[model samples]
Target: MNKDSTQTALLWIVAAGFFMQALDTTIVNTALPSIAHSLGVRPLVMQWAIVAYTLTMATLTPASGWLADRFGTRRVYFTAILIFVLGSVCCASSHTLGQLVIARVLQGIGGSMLLPIGRLAVLRSVSGEQYVSALAMISVAGQVGPIVGPTLGGWFVEAISWHWIFLINVPIGVVGLFAVHRYLPRATSTAAPRFDLTGCALLSLCMIAFSLAVDAPSQSHRAAWSTGLFALGLVSALAYVPYARSRRNPLFKLSLFREPNFSVGLIGNLVCRIGSSAVPFLVPLLLQLQLGYAPLQSGLMMLPAALSGTLAKRWIAPLIRRFGYDTFLLVNTLIVGGSIVAFALITPSTPAIVAIVVLIVFGAANSMQFAAMNSVTLKGLSHEDAGGGNSLFSMVQMLAMGLGVSISGTLVKLFSDQWGSAIFGFRMSFVCVGGITLVAALIFRQIKETPPAIASPAKPAVAGGR
Candidate 1:
C-alpha cells in the first residue's frame, strides 16, 4: 500500500478499537437491570459488574505505554482485541453475578490498552502536523459510541436477548483483528526502561483497597473490614511518595505535581468526576425502576444528554479562551454540580420536557468541564513529563470512575435500606453525589488565572466512560 493508504487504514483500525471500547463503556449501563434480573441479583448490587471493568482498567492502564514500548504496538493492539472478544463471549455466557464481574475484568484488561496504544500508534505513524487531525477523527468514533450505545443496548435487550449486546462485538472485533494484522505497521520495539513494578503495585493496591472500602458496607455490611481497607489504601498511597523518590524511574514522577494546573486539575478531576460519573449508571436505573419506563424508553431519554454533550464540544475552546481555564472550570464545575443535584427532582410527576432540559444543561456543562479539565491538566507539563503525566491522569480518571460507582452504590443501598423506599434512595443518592461534585468547585478555586491564549483545535476529551 502507498504511504497515504497505510495511514488511512491505520486510522480506521484505531478508530474501530476505540469505538468498541467506548461502546462497551455505556452500553452496559442501560442493560444492568436486565443483566441483574437474568443473573438472579438485585439491580443496585450490579455496580460490581461495572466497577470491576473500570477498576481493572485503572489498575492496568499505567502499564499500557510500557507494554507497547517493550512489545510492538501491532502485536499488543491485536492481542487486546482478541482478549476483548474472548471476554465478551465470557460475559454473554455468564450465569451469575460473580461470573459476570470476572468476565468484565477480563474485558477491561483488553480495554485498558486500546485507546492508549492506539493513540501511541497514531503519534508514531503520523507527522506532527497530522497528529491532531488524526486524533480528532479517532475521537469521533469515541463520541459516536456513547451516542448510540445506550439506545443500541436497549434495543438489543428489548427486541432480542440481552446476550446480543456482547454478541454484537464479535463480528466487529473479528474484522478489527484482520484489519490490524493486514494494515497496522509493525513498528519496531524500543529498548524500554525497567517498569516500576513496586510503584505500580502500590498504586494498584491503593485503588483496589479504596474501591473495596467504599463498596464493602454495601456488599457485606462489614464496617471493620471497610475501615481496615480504607486505612490500608491510605497507607499505600502515602507509601508511593517515598518509594517514587527513591526510584530512578518511578511509575509517575512526583514532580509532575509541581505544575499548579496539573495538580489542581488532577484533584479536581478526581473529586468532580466522582459525582458526574455516577449519573450514567444511576440515570437508566432511575428511569426504569423509579419512573416505570421500559428499557427502550429509558434509553431514549438519554438521547438528550448524549446529543447535547456532542454538540457542546465545539463550544469548549472558544469558552476557555474567553473565560480562561480558572474561570471556566470554576463556574462550569458548579453548573455541572448543580445539574447533577437537579436530577433529584426528576420524579414520575416531573414533566418529560423538564427532564430533557435538565439533561441538556448537565450534558453541556459536563462536556465543557472535561475538555477544560483535561487540557489544563496536561497543558502545563514539560515535553519530558507529558507522557508520564498523561498516563497518570488517565489512571486517576479511571480510578475516580470506579470510586464514583462504588460510592454511589453504597449510598443508594444505605438510603434505600434506611428509608425503605427505592425512589427516595435514588433521590438522596443524587443529592449526596451532587454535593460531592460541588466540592470540586472549591478545588478549582485553587487554579491560578492566566491570560487567554489563541484558541487551537480542541483535542478530544477523555472518554467519559459513560
Candidate 2:
C-alpha cells in the first residue's frame, strides 16, 4: 500500500482504540442498576464500579507515555488491547461487586494506555501538516462513543443481559489486535525520560485515599474513617509539591503553575468538573429510578445532550474570539452550573419537552466550557512544558470526574435516608453538586489577563472516565 493508504489504515486502527475506551466509559453508567441487581448489591452503592475504572485510569495515565517510549508503540498498543479485552471478559464473568471492581481496574489499566499510545503511533507515522487532520479523524471516534454508548448499553441490558454490555468489546478488541499488528509502524523514543516512581506513588495513593473516604459506607463510624482518609490524602498530595521541587526531573514541574491562567484554569477544571461530571451518572438514575422510564428509555433521553454538544462545537471559536476566554468562561460557567441545578426541577409530572430543552442548553454550555478551559489551561504553557502540562491536565480531569461521582453518590445516599426517598435524595444531590460548580466559577475570576485562544475546537476533556 502507498504511504497515504498506510497512514489512513493506521488512523482507523487507533480510532478503534479510542472508540472502545470512550464507549466503556458511558456504556456502564446506564447499566449500573442492572449490574448492581445481578451482583446482589444496592444500586446506590454501585458507584464503585465507575469510581474504580476512572480512578485507575487517572492513576495510570501518566505512565503511558513512558511505557510507549521504552517499549515500542505497536507492542504497547497491542498489549493494551489484549489487556482491555481480558478485563472485559473478566467483567462479563464477575459474580460479585468486588470481582467487578477488580475487573474494572484491569480495564482501566488497559484504557489508560490505549489513547496515548495510539496518538504516539500517529505522530511517529505522519508528517506535521497531516498531524491535525489525523488527530481530528481519531477524535471522531471519541465523539461518537458518548453519542451511542448509553443507548447501546441500555439496549444490550434490556434485550439480552447486562453482561453483553461488556462482552460487546470482545469482537472489537479482536479486530483491533489484528489491525494494530498489521498497520501501525514500530517506533520508540530515543531519549525516554526516567520514570517518576515516587511521584506516581504519592499521587496514586492520594487519589485512592480521597476517593475511598468520599465513598465510604454511610455507617456509625463513617465520620471517623472519612476524616482520617481525607487527611491522609491531602497530606500525601501536598507532599508531591516538595518532592517535585527537590528532584531534577520530577513527573511534573512545579513551575508550570507560575502562569496565572494555567493555574486558575487547572483549578477551575477540577472544581467545575466535580459538579458537572455527576450529570451523566445522575441523569440515567433519575430517569429510571425516580420516574418510570426503562433503562433503554433513560439512555435515549441522553441523546439531546450528546447531539447538542456536537453541534455546539462550531459556536465555540466565534464566541471565544468575541468575548475572550475570561469573559466567556465566567458567563458560561454559570450557565453550565445553573443547567445542572435545573435538573432538580425534573419530576414525574415535568414535561419531556422541558427536560429536553434543559439537556440541550446544558450540553452546549458545557461543551463550550470544556473547549475554553482546556485551551486556556494549555495555551499558557511554553512549548517545552506543553506535554507534561497536558498530561497533568488530563489526569486532574479524570480524578475530578471520579471525585464528582463519589460526591454525588454520597450526597444521594445521605439524603435518601434523611428525606426518606430516593427522589428527594437525587434532587438534593443535584442542588449540592450544582452549588459546588457555581462556587467554582469564583476560581475562574483569578484569571486576570486573558490568554489567546486556539483556533481549533478542543476535544471534550474526559470527565470521570467519559
Q: All predictions: root-mean-square deviation over Cα? A: 1.7, 1.9
In order, the Cα lDDT scores of the candidates are 0.88, 0.87
lDDT of 2 by residue, 202-273 (tens): 999998999989886568698889989999999999999999999999999998998788889899999999
- Residue pairs clashing, model 2: none
In model 2, the number of clashes is 0
Report the lDDT tens digits of candidate 1 across residue range 98-201: 99999999999999999989988888899889988898898889989988999998999999988988888899999999999999998778999999899999
lDDT of 1 at 440: 97
Clash number for each model: 0, 0
Give the poorly placed runs of model 1, Cα more than 4 Å off: 218-221, 454-466
